[model samples]
Target: MDINIRRAVIHNVSENNQDQLRDTIVDAMQKGEEKYLPGLGVLFEVIWQNADEQEKGMMLDTLENGLKQT
Candidate 1:
């Protein structure tokens, strides 16, 4: 097994490298809008599509109780 990383190259990066990483990520996301997820939409879609009868009953009970607190 072998692994290699250039520590000196990493250390040479500018002082603002944290912000540089954030900017790079933002740029990548701007370039890939179609790949981004809306969190709640994905959650509900998975629950609706895959839940069994037992799971559906439990989920409805949880949701009903959850709504009463709001």
Candidate 2:
């Protein structure tokens, strides 16, 4: 495979670790903030930029519902 493709595959795998896509988004946010706990607003931006429409919708619904249940 091409180097770029290989890198992308590896990155996607790392992002999808833990069986929860949210972890990837959260990790990105944390990195941006240079901290352990990520801010919700930054997380939203990172997720929005990276996720497709379907994934974005799913994540939004999941997060909203999860929030409501709290």
Candidate 3:
């Protein structure tokens, strides 16, 4: 059984609108289930690929700050 997680995740959410995407993310996070992590990673990959340099920098800064809280 060959499961392409990234492809599956992307396919699942490909037609989602902004609000639906937000709901998916929020639900995943609130549930804190390991199964949802791959989907979140795929979403992050899409965001990273589409982001500008400044946006990437901001994401990095936010990540850095988030790490400090842990």
Candidate 4:
């Protein structure tokens, strides 16, 4: 089986409104399932591509702090 995960993820959420998007993300994280990781990665890829330096720095800092907690 062949699958384009990034494309599929984008397609699934591209039309979502802000509230819907937030719900989707929150639900995905709350579920804590391995299958959801790829979708999150795709979302993060979009964020990374569009984020400015300051935003990127903040994201990295947040990720760093999150890892420290584990």
Candidate 1 global lDDT: 0.57
Estimate, for each residue in 24-48, the C-alpha lDDT of model 2 and write its tens digit. Answer: 6556666776542334444455558
Global lDDT scores for all candidate models: 0.57, 0.62, 0.96, 0.97
> Top lDDT: which candidate number?
4
lDDT of 1 by residue, 10-58 (tens): 3433354668756745665677765433332343554577889999989
Ten-residue region with minimum lDDT total, candidate 2: 34-43
Cα shift from native, residue 46, model 3 (Å): 0.6
Residue 70 alpha-carbon offset, candidate 3, angstroms = 2.2
In angstroms, the error of model 1 at 12 is 32
Say which candidate scores most in TM-score. Answer: 3
Error of 1 at 1 (Å): 47
Which of candidates 1 and 2 is the stronger one according to lDDT? 2
What is the Cα-based TM-score of model 2? Answer: 0.39
Report the lDDT tens digits of candidate 3 across residue range 1-70: 9999999998999999999999999999999999889889999999999999999999999999999999
Clashes of 2: 0
lDDT score of residue 70 within candidate 4 = 100
Q: What is the lDDT of residue 60 in candidate 1?
A: 92
Candidate rank order under TM-score: 3, 4, 1, 2
- Give the Å error, residue 36, model 2: 7.0
Model 1 clash tally, residue pairs: 0
Query: Which lDDT value does model 3 have at 55?
Result: 100
